[model samples]
Target: MPKEIAGPEVTPGARETQLGEWRIVALKDASFALDGGAMFGVVPRVMWERLTKVNSDHTVPLATTPYLLDNGTYRVLIEPGMGLRWGEKQTAMFHISHDEGHELVTSLRAAGVEPEEITHCLMSHCHWDHIGAACGADGLPVFPKAQHWCPQSERDAALHPDHLRRASYRKEDLQPIIEANLLQTFEGETEILPGLKMVELGGHSDGISLVILETAEGKAAFWADIVPTSNHVHLPFIMAYDMNAALSWEVRTKWIPLAAEEGWLNLLYHDLDQPMGRFVVDAKKRYTFAAI
Candidate 1:
């Protein structure tokens, strides 16, 4: 497990570590809850309810975690986070909670980073929660100086979502990036930076992608929503929110083992308890996690 910046005694707050030449910092934008049934897909409530606290509304708490990778020159931010544009209804529905200054930029500034310093903004997908902070309430790109990137499909989905995915994407959240000419889109897999790449996997959404960073230290993966939290580690534990459960299973089957065997430092996006850990496969071939 990577050491917490505040020391071992501190359990909550941002975590920082050095991965090869990059300085990685995990920042929390907001704490919210999602429908438990929607989150566990085909898994029985009996199996998952015991793993985490469930609110009276049957929602499971989750954190919107955005990671900042800095190596003096380029500062790349992954996952823009659920910004503060929700209305009363949406806020109440999600049980969103955060301190006064809880937006991604606020969290970035708290970590000694200003919005302008961000060189690139990477997206695993443009689901509202993952890309909400890309723009501000005034409909402008928040990180004006950063070149925002995502799969070409995600950009299309965000701009013109079908009935099924309409709610997951908000045009206002991504339009400004396009208008500002800051949005960069790719297909299949592309390395946006040296040692950093985004691989598109459409299981979660039409064009959702996963990020990979490799260096002398090792490989690190950002498992956006595929294996959202540590609890979703089971092979069958796909999320109902996924666009294609079968594809999600296949993706999980392939990557989970590779991550375990290769000893990649896995960064989770929605886990509330622990965001960073390494996959561990025991003799029985069952997978588990060892916190970093």
Candidate 2:
């Protein structure tokens, strides 16, 4: 049984902040929902329920938050989008919806960027929710001129997911990008740009990675599904859908504290209301988030 509760409030738009030489913006895309129980993993419903509202079907709303990293010379787009590939059945099932202005291309245009202007497209993983907009309806790459990057393991997983994981991936999403000769796959920690790097942390999926950017001004980490929402700042809040729960715990244990102590700007991918924030450890030695 699900209890009636209010959904997280969302501020819809292009949220921007400047980190050193780069202008980082969280571009809105299709919003959807996921099973609350699966989202909270081992955490009890009574414990996680208070942090977020639940739909009648026990699903919690999630935001598809992709980021745009723009330095004067190069424009990097991370976690492309939830995309527009969902059919009416899937859309209704997931409660997916986005206004015209919230479309990836529209959001990019609103941020004063054109699709072709994107120099690099990075996907933390190839899960359909994360790389849905890799192509368009015409089966063409959306960022036609950009060099797309993904973890080699994730690329393989997306292309050939096992029986239990097949539902989370779609081959069509990556086929066009592959055929275009624009997709670049990496094995481990690789510096994609001067100050930007991808650190592969396998947990939620085999090849999910963390995108980190550091410059003279400050540092920021794009926490793919590792820490999808601010509510997941705690170390044990791993998602049940993760392929490797123990690995997720190990990764979160190491990174969450580092982000807090260093005061890095933590960019969340699925938090609907609070998209970006800083992890803070209080006097009580408990983790809390200071939303940005």
Best by lDDT: 2
- Candidate 1 Cα lDDT to native: 0.85
Tell me each candidate's TM-score.
0.94, 0.94
Off by over 4 Å in 1: 1-14
Q: Least lDDT summed over 10 consecutive residues: which range in candidate 1?
A: 1-10
Model 2, range 109-197, lDDT digits (tens) per residue?
99999998999999999999999887976768999999999999999998888997899999999988999999999998889999899
Q: Against the true structure, what is every candidate's RMSD?
A: 3.5, 6.0
lDDT (tens digit, per residue) of candidate 1 on 1-292: 2222211222333377777888888887888999999999888899899989999999999989999999898999999898878899989999887775556877899989999999999999999899887887676788989989999999898899999989899988888888889988999999989999999988989877889998887888899998899888767788999998889888989999888777787788999868787777776777776674
Worst 10 residues of 2 by lDDT: 1-10
- lDDT on C-alpha atoms for all candidate structures: 0.85, 0.86
Q: Residue 214's C-alpha lDDT in candidate 1?
A: 89
How well does candidate 1 match the true structure in TM-score terms? 0.94
